[model samples]
Target: MSRIWDRMSLNFLSEDISVKSMKRSKQKTNVLLISAVCLSLSACGEFSYKRGASANDFQQEKKSCATQHKNDADVDACLANSGWIVVSADKPLFAEATTTDNKMPVQMTSDDKVIAEKPVDPLELIAVGSWWKTGAAPNALIADSEQCVTELGEAHQTRNNMSLVTRGLVGCMSAKGWFALKK
Candidate 1:
């Protein structure tokens, strides 16, 4: 009887230990699940951040090339003469413009064979704000001449502003039959 009682007590203690270990395992699993959920939520939030211009915003801007200036070479010359510097004459011509401070550099590119070439002062281009012009003899060649000065002043990152200018110039170049390459 004594031996039986001792065995029963040992069995109870073993069962109690098993229950405690199981509880600990469950708690660990819960912690891991919570951590995973939090991490996934943070990642999702980051993926949803805004990046580029809106479709409607683009429609509102005035286009540079009129029906007459649609020829590729003529368009290229028009842009180059207006202040866009040809950086690459390859399949996609690359070019850059500068801010008035000469501190920021905005680049542009073309899609097809590069014909015209010229050396440009990026700093002087930006300082004078010549990239923002329209008409046959535009003073400057801005994608949206109306907003060039305002946007540059409001831009927080000078480099980013440069990039925006470069993109606009590339688009103008592409319109002129020059393939604008992604930098």
Candidate 2:
């Protein structure tokens, strides 16, 4: 009888331990789920891009482009150039991109072969208040602003507001068909 009781007690203890373990596992899962939700929400509002334009102007430009028989790319280019930017929602503008790339290219790879890194989409970059420039090689994006400084020439380096220099670089790149923000 005593031996039977001992075995029964052992079984009960094992069951208790398993129940506690299950509870802990569930708690951990809940914590992970909450963490994942918060992480996703943080990335939500970071994708809005805005230019110095009004909603009315954006609508008008979009309507005008609709009237034209231009391709989708041409319409987007017209809107972008006309100071309209793609926004995630009708949310208020947070900030304008004022960054300048002044770093000079230190070295180049020996091979002329393109590395084929994913071309960072310009709309996405603009949404995040960033910039992209065409690289010297075909299908290549200049990795950083050192090339911009070089392309702008030494005369631009002396400017009080480097943002203007950045604007100039962007204008130059846009004029050359490099500013097409992929829809």
Candidate 3:
């Protein structure tokens, strides 16, 4: 009787240990699954994945023509000569031509300051706009010269006969040479 009782006790303890081990394994699996799901979600949320260098954000160290050259006017002239257009002033932005035929619009302030200018290909500008509107980047409108160019092109192509100021950005981009008015 003593032997049989000992065997039965041992069996019961073994079964309990097995059940605990199984539960532990299941919990570990659940944890691993949750971790994987969270990682995937985080990756999906990331914008601007695998993007190349952005010319829109010009760094003084890497992109500035000032130190190597002399004066803002000289730098501006150098950029203009290279076919880079000043797309924005507040941030000092510029764009290069994707093709030779396209010309950047000249920017003239009310105070008669010449800011910046460059030549830009029309089709390339349009493509860039479309890419911005539906690209993997975080925000499209932040550097969207293409949108302005496309609108201007459409206005002109439709023969809307709008004023140069109102003709949309594409037409402005299409004009012969763009310039940034100096302040």
User: What lDDT score goes with residue 127 in model 3?
Assistant: 16
- Cα miss at 120, model 1 (Å)? 52
The CA-based lDDT of model 3 is what? 0.45
Report the C-alpha displacement of residue 157, candidate 3, in angstroms.
48
TM-score of every prediction relative to native: 0.25, 0.28, 0.25
**Number of clashing pairs per prediction, in order:** 22, 1, 20
The reply for model 2, stretches above 4 Å from the true place, is 44-183
The segments of candidate 1 whose C-alpha lies over 4 angstroms from its true place after superposition are 44-183
Q: Write the per-residue lDDT of candidate 1 for residues 55-89, one digit (tens) a residue.
A: 34322221363334877667545544544432232
lDDT of 3 at 105: 70
| lDDT values, one for every candidate | 0.43, 0.52, 0.45
Candidate number with greatest TM-score: 2
TM-score between candidate 2 and the true structure: 0.28
Writing each residue's lDDT as its tens digit, candidate 3 over 1-183 gives: 999999999999999999999999999999999999677645533211113435453344225666667776677655545444433224322233333455567776788976455634343312121112223343433234345546455533322221122223433443433421211
